[model samples]
Target: MALPTSPPEPARLAGDNWLANCAEWPDLVRQAWRVEALGTIVTGTRWLAAEAPLVVVLAAMKRIPHAELGPVLADPTVEKGWWLVPLDAADHLSDIRQLRVRPPGWPLRCPPTGWQLCGRFWLQPPDGSGLVTAPPLLGAALGPGGPRLPAEAFG
Candidate 1:
């Protein structure tokens, strides 16, 4: 399969979602991820330190109080360092599953739309051919206070 390709402006922070507050801090906003399939952009934050910045952008776009998305956006682990994995499309899919199944820390969810978001991602430098995969370190921050909300809430 071909690598995913997002729209040129996918990372545009002009939406009403939870991350509208990031506009003021263009530097932080620049690191946002453009999820090609989802057609939206999300800031790659390692902890809650980036929350204030993100909240600002989200509030502006959503035209609401940034506080509304606080709890979800306040997750501390998201502030940790990021990994860059290099893998073909097939390997990417496999690695995603391995990340979800092998490690309990994976923030796995099969949304009604049928797409999965590994809230916690793992990565590494490229291999000899400049291809590497970053798999989440399963239980790093997921043991107790991790980001995975209670399953009951979703049910």
Candidate 2:
């Protein structure tokens, strides 16, 4: 005789769709599971993020007015942080030598929304509303990185 199968649990069902901001969300969750470190994807869109030392990241976070902050991913192991910003961030932050504005189409590995812990986790997770850091505010907070230096400046 064939046995009946039970449906996936309620919490299991809700968990899967909470961060369904993008179309690939379900697949991304599966990918997160495959990674096993509880990480999700920060991809698509015309956005670019600024990757900087943890200190700088925190500094900017503090400077942003009010209590309103946006999604952020942090990696303690590397002492680095990434902030989700608009597409124009590249030109706005061009002077920042201490940071790197990730090129668009870069698939950043971040923790799924909510309180997830791993080597690389979200400092500020997405709020399920697809909100991102305001570019002008972020730019103002970090100020300018000063002009880019010549290669020999490092040597």
Candidate 3:
């Protein structure tokens, strides 16, 4: 798969108006997004990236009250109403890798596993005007269904 040639858009928070406009988003579409979740509710963030424009919808979910979006986002440490930012893919990924190499809890972590660090990614495109199926990995693990979620189920 080819990497997106266009420059990444600036990071932005999907605010209240944004969420209202997307009230029908998840129901109207089913595109998968690649995202990274970090920090606690008061200061946590989610980074969502997709090949096409639907990334905006995923980011919109971040606007919901934590009590509502929390289960889906599934972060326990965070409080409610956390913020979401749409990241500049290339730059964000690069920064994350660099940080992993020198994380604050380095020695204690033993083997630094940067697996949480998202690199390049691709998501299923929206059909003419319908919800997409499961979001699948486009570059490295493209074969069948969407990218496999972790084995453990979210409660």
Candidate 4:
């Protein structure tokens, strides 16, 4: 699919949100897979690219207490969050290829063997299949920006 020329609108989910407004393309979603974990929380930084807009989805895993503030103190709970960032084929060519060439040690229990380049996002399925570059769509709906996690994701 052609790179979205203009930014799309954003979509909101329970633990995820799209930074850009993108259409809910069934085909793309069908091709997409959920990323359950990462090598480190810092890996989320790699998802951001200047070439194209990326959607970063994050989910909270567990909660912890703030040492500075006691449990009885004001809002002192902290949550461990995971993130999923989508990359565009044209924009993140180098980064995507590099990951495939030399898969990094992400803090995942079962690291991804490879990635699937769907319409606009780089997907990593639970299956161990290697890299897959999707064929371009003639008239695929390229939505706005991309997905993002909630505020808690950063903390």
| lDDT winner | 2
Q: In model 4, what lDDT does residue 90 have? A: 35
In candidate 4, what residue range of length 10 has the lowest lDDT sum? 67-76
TM-score (C-alpha) between model 1 and the true structure:
0.16
- What lDDT does the true structure give each of the candidates? 0.24, 0.63, 0.23, 0.21
Query: Each candidate's root-mean-square deviation in Å?
Result: 17.5, 11.4, 18.1, 19.3
lDDT of 4 by residue, 102-125 (tens): 123232121112321222222222
**Which residue ranges in model 1 land beyond 4 Å of their true spot?**
1-18, 26-31, 35-70, 73-155
| Evaluation by TM-score, superior candidate among 1 and 2 | 2
What is the lDDT ranking, best to worst? 2, 1, 3, 4
Best by TM-score: 2
lDDT of 1 by residue, 1-155 (tens): 12321222322222212232322343333333333121222222211111122233223224322222221221123533322222222233243321221221222111111112333221111111222122221221222332343468797
Segments of candidate 4 deviating more than 4 angstroms = 1-37, 41-88, 91-124, 133-155
Candidate 1 backbone clash number: 19
- Residue 49 local lDDT, model 4: 17
Show where candidate 2 strays beyond 4 Å.
1-20, 23-25, 38-42, 144-155
